[model samples]
Target: MDIGFASSYLRSLFLTSLFSFVAPLLLMGSTIAGLSIISYVPWLGRLSQPGFELVWAFLRTFGNGNALEGSLVIGSTCGLVGALFDTYIFYRQNTFRR
Candidate 1:
């Protein structure tokens, strides 16, 4: 493998993993914030109960430490799958170039 290509690929894989790790936290935060704001509306407050319960359940699961392990397993699997897909695309492009 070319050193430059390898380095670039590794960098991309790292970034993909980093994003995969962070994206959920960001999404959860935003979702909670949105729900909090929505709950302030009287009519919508009723609807927010289920959403809050769902988020609470998620947090409760995480609080027990299961979520961390699950997230790691799932995230790594997804990252590896993404890396393999990227690698295949890169290989196909290089092969075509040659």
Candidate 2:
């Protein structure tokens, strides 16, 4: 693949990994924040349960809160590694240019 294509692929992988990590943090934060907001609107709060459940499951295994947290940690680590790899690739490509 050309550099552009390769870079795009890499970027997508990076974003996927970033999302894997960030999404959970975002979801967890949202969930906690939602909890506070829900208290104010009892009926709406109940309605939010399904959304929270869906996010939790997507972020974790079987909607387990702890698992979601773990995924966030692991995904962040993987994202870092992927970034470093991308940087190294760029460096090598630039170094080869006249």
Best by TM-score: 1
TM-score to native of every candidate shown: 0.64, 0.44
RMSD of each: 3.3, 8.1
- C-alpha lDDT (0 to 100) for residue 12 of candidate 2: 65
Q: Runs in model 1 with CA error above 4 Å?
A: 58-77
The worst-scoring run of ten residues by lDDT in candidate 1 lies at 65-74
Q: Give the per-residue lDDT of model 2 (tens digit) for 1-98.
A: 48986888677667766765676567567775786677478778777777766655666663355655655665677667766766677677768984
Total backbone clashes of candidate 1, pairs 3 or more residues apart or in separate chains: 0
Candidate 1 residue-wise lDDT, 10-41, digit = tens: 89777876777666666666878889899999
Candidate 2, lDDT over the whole model: 0.66
